[model samples]
Target: MTRLDTLSARGRDFLGSTHAIMAGAMTWVSERNLVSAISNAGGFGVIACGAMPPHILDAEIAATKALTDRPFGVNLITLHPAMADLIAICGKHDVSHVVLAGGLPSGAAIEAIKATGAKLMCFAPTAALAKKLVRSGVDAIVIEGSEAGGHIGPVSTSVLAQEILPVIRDVPVFVAGGIGRGAAIAAYLEMGASGVQLGTRFAAATESVAHANFKRAFVRASARDALASVQLDPRLPVIPVRALKNAGSEAFAAKQREIANLVDAGTIGLAEGQLQIEHYWAGALRRAVVDGDIESGSLMAGQSVGMVTSVMQVAEIIDELVGEAEAALSNRAA
Candidate 1:
């Protein structure tokens, strides 16, 4: 039997999940309600603290604790101005698993998190950074590829996961990006990932806080729908983020042209200067996720969005995925 026939015993202990799947933390989407549901369903759920205030973050953590005794994590955006406060909150709550996104946490912050005995997980784009994080004492590293939604990394998960796994034996590796089904999960495990992390799939789950329109968009999406938002000029301030290609993206591109013209004419005021992130793009996603308006809102989804057909309960989805992964392994053994 191959290594895939037996789920990695080491992988299960750190993941704290019966299913070798993790719900990727998403801003607005990964609230206490949704996070608890996934954790309770036998997968890891990470509460996203991206846009939340310190008080709100604390309350959410408390709320999640009340809902489930299962192990769950909190995602802290390392680039946020209040990152120090966020890390402090995690330590105060005894949140043992913290997923650091955006950029590497400061050495001081990393040390503080380590002091709390929490497992530090960060997104690494290059093998060098992955090694550095492990050396810095991170417990696990998530290699995010360009195919993922929200902010993505430069390398594909396929390439990065393969490169990092053989080099790093001390830490667990979780592959993120383009993972949304049992087959994908099985493939990653076969490729040597400790586990798989999924965001787009959970975003379309029944208990997701995303707007109905947002889930519908994911359901209707095809594999080709995921692409980085193309900028008309190289000087645009906002970084490229992957999203379902739709009318909202087109509108944002058009607005970008207006911003460019204003800059050329020297008529752009400091207050009026447009930030692509401040435009309806991010907030538009809020419209879709919170209100379910597909046409006017931006849809944050992964390439696997095409595979999501209908929204189901978190437990049912987790069970189905686990069953399929196990069956695939069993068949492979034969």
Candidate 2:
């Protein structure tokens, strides 16, 4: 059997592909072009439906279908206001998979997606939560760590794989965060991960719609340059987001301090102050991704950004990863 065939049955079956690699859905960057390119390249691509309304998601799904007939998934943030409608849109398109991200999915949302006969995937930050998600009817689990881009949990992918991979027997577990090459993929599969997901590695693919300047930043960055957003005040609520440290991130720190001062002065309620901080990042991702304003826009990236050296085609990236994986497995067996 080939190295691809050596993957766990659950992994191959869940992805329905020769390789179990997945191109992680990135906001603004994972629209029709990148999603379809990855799927056509024999890896699953997920559309990042980050905070998009129902109509926009419908259009994007239709556009992706126009590009390729291969199976793909849609990733929706659990906290989206129109989540129910978004799930309905997936059903309407006969989408094969739905990945719920951001936070714990509501029971109703889970049921709605399951009712569509679509495979439901969720992010599990801990092994305990992995079990709970399976019990709650999630078909697959993606264990993502702080090394990932955008919003992140507090654990590393290696630690999460060790903790969750062995016990989550009911469903396939895919590892994400800081995975930049096929050697890591092979190692994780050996450790019981059914597949792997990568965002930073794929963000600079030729098919990706990220602005040229944005991709350049990724190529030039080192792992040390990718830092998680910091909270200035202990009392205020802050959701840590991982991204390249640039002018935008520095400004975000100042913005938080300003908001915290307002809260201390009672000029704004604590909740409102938190909301203001959230609003500061609202369109920042788009500005960086689409407009190429890297300095002031949030250049969200994972630690793996350091591994990206050039812009290659999606098919080339997949082939490189799989070849590296096969070679690793071969060397180990020898």
Candidate 3:
């Protein structure tokens, strides 16, 4: 096998794909077209089931399956109210992998996915959690850092890798965030990463159904344009979301303040307030991704946004990534 394949062997085998590269399950953008395209291109595609009801997710999985016979996965938000039903849909469709995101999954959720005979993957913010998830019977672990788009934790990808990779050995560990090139992939693989996940770069892919304005915005953006939101209230327990600076981002701060006030006034409890905040983000993202409302919609993107210079085909993007990784490994050997 070639250098790229060699480095990605474990992850590739686990994913049943030619490359271990996974397209990050971006909400609104990671629907049937892009997901199938990635899987057809010999990379893994994960359908983002962000707040999607069970029926919608079922149809999505079916649509994606019709488009490609290649293996792909489904990403389900752990906190989604229909988590159990979603897992059942994945089982009904026999999805090969089920990734749990948004928050730590309960044992019941883990068992439900595994009961479907699907490989289970969960995100870990710390090494402690990595070990804990492994002990909980997760088939794999994804360590996404603060530079990642959408919701994020405080640590950087490199720091998380340094802290988690050496210590977690039982299952495949995929590193994400701020990784826009093959050289970065090579570095992580050398550090024992099974593979990598990228979202922003793929968001502009020709196969992605993101609106033209959305693609254009990503094309023109720089790394600095992507900033993580701040928590306006300690009681609200907001998760920092990294996205391109826009009116919608500023609006989110105001929205948070408003929700926090509701929490203060007893109009809504913390849980209900947080749910409203989540719904607001979902709507805002759909506005940007589907409706082309760039100014007041969430342009969720990673620090890798600058590298997405143009809209490219999914196959082309995967080839370029593998090529870059090969060159990096070759240069190191030389």
Candidate 4:
């Protein structure tokens, strides 16, 4: 039997009822409505709590519960100042899964959540960190490659998963980055991943909260659009973020230079626009996602954006992905 057919016994056990294909925890976009849709559709949905306040996150969690009885997750960015409060809220709501994005969570935070019996999911960039998180008590680890959207590690999923999966025997490993279809999912499963997580494909889903123009951008995006910018000097002070190459990104690159010049001159305060790339929000992204302004907004998409051609409902998206994995496995046998 092929690896896809005989997935890791431990990996399968971790996924339980909801199959692979986890929806990423996108800030501002992963509200209750979107999170509920993915979970109700049989894939795991994560409420992006990275940006919301604790009270707001609690309400969002309640809202998600109102929408579906199936298990879902909450995404907590490890670097945020409010991490403790968010963990408290997750436990209060009995949120079963907490995905620690951006970086690993603090040891105290991890212990607190574990005490609540919540499954912890974290991103590990290297084999060392992967084993470290396993020892740190993470229930599962998402190996995010340089191909993933938003902030990413230097390593690719192919390299990280291959090196880490072999050493970590207890926790399930989910591969993220450049995954948009069933063929990729099947390949990862064959590689011993418990499941695959998708971000860009869902950003274009019918129920996605991203701007319509943003969605179109993702649908039209290519691998070339997903290049990671070089941070020549760490002292320059800019957070490295993975975004599609567009006027916004290019403009932001220039803006960074200007901001640096101003900071050196002591002319303007650096309190706001810390990540000027995000300010491109005022550009086309708002018009595209919220106003359906498909031409103007900066669409945040993965390299897999090119793989998507049409807008599909949540259920259709899940069905098509699963079908693709099945077909690839079947053909491998033939």
Q: Residue 208, candidate 4: how far off, in angstroms?
A: 1.1
Residue-by-residue lDDT tens digits, candidate 3, 1-334: 8877787899999999989999899999999999999999999999999878889999999999999999999999887888889999999999999999988899999999999999999999999999999999999999998999999999999999999999998899999999999999999999999999999999999999999999999999999999999988888787889999999999999999899888889999999998899888889999999999999999999999989998999999999998899999999999
**Number of colliding residue pairs in each model:** 3, 0, 0, 9
Q: List TM-score per model, in order.
A: 0.92, 0.98, 0.98, 0.90
**How far is 305's C-alpha from truth in model 4 (Å)?**
0.3
TM-score of model 2 relative to the true fold? 0.98
**Model 3 misplacement above 4 A:** none
Candidate 2 lowest-lDDT run of ten = 1-10
Q: Write the per-residue lDDT of candidate 4 for residues 149-184, one digit (tens) a residue.
A: 776677787888789878876878889998887988
- lDDT score, candidate 1: 0.81
lDDT of 3 at 231: 87
Q: Report the number of backbone clashes for model 4.
A: 9
Worst 10 residues of 1 by lDDT: 269-278
Q: Quote the lDDT for 254 in model 4.
A: 71
* Model 4 deviation from native, Cα RMSD in Å: 2.8
| Least well predicted 10-residue stretch by lDDT in candidate 4 | 273-282
